[model samples]
Target: MNQIDLGGKIVVITGGAGGIGQAIAQRALASGASVCSWDNAPTAAQATAGIASMQVDITSEAAVTAAYADTIAKFGRIDVLVNSAGITGPTLTVQDYPLDAWLKVMAINLTGTFLCSRAVVGGMVQNGYGRIVNMASVAGKEGNPLQSAYSASKAAVIALTKSMGKELAKVDVRVNCIAPAMIESALLDQMPASKRAENLAKIPMGRAGTVDEIAAMALWLASEECSFTTGATFDASGGRATY
Candidate 1:
């Protein structure tokens, strides 16, 4: 574990209770940054000494506002924001996809990321330094079969990241996203075994990525060393991403 210096930085990670999110939080703390996790459920047990946990419904504007306010009050400033909150909607063909289910996925995966990013970007712009890392998926780049909602939502996220990154190009506030292939996490449990195998087959590495691997890339993007890149998609898909 090569330590990246994050001293004096304050990071806010959404969906911070999940495996990948928690891994990112752990890395941030290890790098000397204060972390505040925002999630829909309780994740206090995951917090260490320098980390704080807050329950937030990212889909709700009011809840997101209050949560960011609480985070600001506690940390005084948000140096980095990681929009990691998302859900894998049920596996269904677009023709048979449930309208309610599609809406739910969009509400959480896409709109939720937008809400969280909007909440912190103002302060970051004012301060002239910020890093926003949005969690996108390889499925976003290459549309997965029977997962139209999840794929479309993440594709929108990729677009959003590019647009925002370019918008902030001169502001010292970099925005980027990672397009990771299937990762080994609780989220995978949502998929049927056949679906999981089908997804895995696309990865040339023949293995799912670890949370630590994703966290490492995320940490780099959140660091000053990632100075030259913005509005770019970093691939952690193990050759699954074709473009």
Candidate 2:
């Protein structure tokens, strides 16, 4: 819990109502930043002081655009964007996976990231300062069984981070992503019990990571201290990721 100063910064965290997203929002607030959490299903708890919550579907172009406008109206500008909204589609073999489910997963995980990232680029570039930390997964690095859609979508997120990072390389904006193994969060509950156990067993630490650990990494990436690194995937896989 080393201190990272984010004074006077305004952060927008998608999926801010969820476990990991919420943690990041709270951390940012504690770091002296104003936070606006955008989620499709916002919660009462997100009504915390210093945080503005918006019900937004990142998958919709219009919704994303509107959210950006509202955010700008509220905060004047966005300093950080954490694309944490995501889903792990149903657990099933590729042949048994529903087409609709696959599409839905891609829509939320990959397309949503793209839309949100696009929404903030203009403002960030104009301001000459921005930090984008996308939430990817170790599964994206090493494909997991019964998680085809989730894996594929996150892989695309990693690629998108790289592309955006390079596009803004000459600017002060820095784009990066986190590839966490099996973080203990509500999303992990979506996996079958056996599958969860299998994934945890692969980690040398022999335990799932916590929301705080991921939040710490995110907070640093969002800070000025993270300079000199862009288009990179920071691993928080508990020793699960080899490369």
| Highest lDDT against the true fold, candidate | 2
lDDT, candidate 2, at 216 = 96
Compared with the true structure, model 2 gives a TM-score of 0.99
**Which of the numbered candidates is closest to the native, going by highest TM-score?**
2
Predicted structure 2: lDDT? 0.95
Per-residue lDDT of model 1, residues 1-243, tens digit only: 888999999999999999888899989999999999999974657765557999999999999999988988898999999999889999999999999999999999999999999999999999999999999999898899999999999999999999999999999999999999999999999899999999999899999999999999999999999898999999999888879
Candidate 2 pairs with clashing backbones: none
Show model 1 residue runs off by greater than 4 Å: none
RMSD of 2: 0.7
**What tens-digit string does per-residue lDDT give for candidate 2 at 40-122?**
99998789555799999999999999999999998899999999999999999999999999999999999999999999999
Model 2 bad stretches (over 4 Å): none
Give per-residue lDDT, candidate 1, residue 83.
Answer: 92
Which residue pairs in candidate 1 collide?
none
